[model samples]
Target: MMSGGNLSQYLAKSIAVMVFGSNDYINNYLLPSIYSSSYNYSPPDFANLLLNRYARQILALHSVGLRKFVVAGIGPLGCIPNQLATGQAPPGRCVDYVNQMLGTFNEGLRSLVNLLNGNHPGAIFVYGNTYGIFGDILNNPATYGKKILHFLN
Candidate 1:
């Protein structure tokens, strides 16, 4: 049987994994015809807005006794199947524009990881390089024992 303090300590040791930002871009920001975000803010501004909220959310978790975190950044949105299906890219390429916008968000996420670790004592925040890892896999699929399949229109 664990006491209240012991239970809290045990819970704190459990790492929390957080991933966000993809749906915001693909479902909201990119759909200017359906959303006003594109008109209200540029890509960089949108990314900043997301990071501000993200920082707060993470802090809220920290305040609740979560001391270990694994925060993953948004991956290459342009390379995803849904984006690729839009037929914006050339025969065998990704939508660079979407990827670039996501890059801004991912970069800010990296900074957020550093900021959280430095500002909060006794708390550890690790940044998952999801963007880099996904990009590498997309760029060199063969190296990872798989090949990207391209479709014909």
Candidate 2:
């Protein structure tokens, strides 16, 4: 218990950055490669399941001590180089299904964040629009473009 100056201040001011939803939804639920979870739940139902779980985790943190949370949603999952390399889509294009599913998942995540912020007192939950930012970059690469990259490479 080394409270040199004030440990309560630090604990009270703690901010949690939760960046998830891509793996659980994309790898386990959305991918067509046949994941057990995917077979068990439909797209929308899977999105609900993921969002519900994420919200529970965030609320648990909120209940304990932390308040400010930066909850980041999934980006354009199917737009990566690997999906493009499947040869199923035209060059420099992404698989539409995965991207669409990601968007749906993001909507649920954003709504959950909003609901959490409303329910919790003095809790500041900032929903990180990861998908929006990446979508903008992909759509207008010249404006906001960076080479070399992600799950693809």
Candidate 3:
């Protein structure tokens, strides 16, 4: 369940910055409520559920005069370096099915944003693309000249 607790804190604290990110799988297939236990719908059947829900939430917030929010769409999950490294196939090969799922999720998110923008005059929803940035880093880590390592410290 997505909560507005952080947003409330931001409003109270007068914070001007907020950031959000979504995992590839989540962005694509899971956002829709169809995948939810409350709904026994399949992936393709629940295609646009997530986007529609997000739009509704945005509109509800806007009705209360809460504007200025950022929502990010998912990125290409199939191309992550972790996926590539773990594969026994050729280099740079991504999992097509996973990417397709993410594509669906992003599509839904974009549709939701469009619906909110079109219906409400004062609604402010900024679409951030965190997936692309992370994907770029994963693709070419050396370009940033920073080595990322995971260890038990």
Taking all chains together, each candidate's TM-score versus the true structure is 0.90, 0.83, 0.57
Off by over 4 Å in 3: 1-44, 76-94, 149-153
| Candidate numbers sorted by TM-score from highest down | 1, 2, 3
* lDDT of candidates 1 onward, in order: 0.87, 0.76, 0.55
The clash tally of candidate 1 reads: 0
Give the top-scoring candidate (lDDT). Answer: 1
Q: List the residue pairs that clash in candidate 1.
A: none
Please write out the lDDT profile of model 2 over residues 33-132, one tens digit for every residue: 7778777887788888888888788877776668789999888877876566666666567778878877667888888888888888788999999988
Model 1 off-target regions past 4 Å?
Answer: 1-7, 146-153
The 10-residue segment with the lowest total lDDT in model 3: 15-24
Best by TM-score: 1
Q: State candidate 1's TM-score.
A: 0.90
Candidate 1 worst ten-residue window by lDDT: 144-153
- Model 1, 1-153: lDDT tens digits are 988799789869889999888889989998899999999999999999999999989988888789999999998888788888988998678889998888788889999999888998899999999989988876676887766663322
For each of the candidates, the C-alpha root-mean-square deviation to the true structure, in angstroms, is 2.2, 3.4, 7.5
lDDT score of residue 24 within candidate 3: 18
Greater lDDT among 1 and 3 belongs to 1
Which structure is stronger by TM-score: 1 or 3? 1
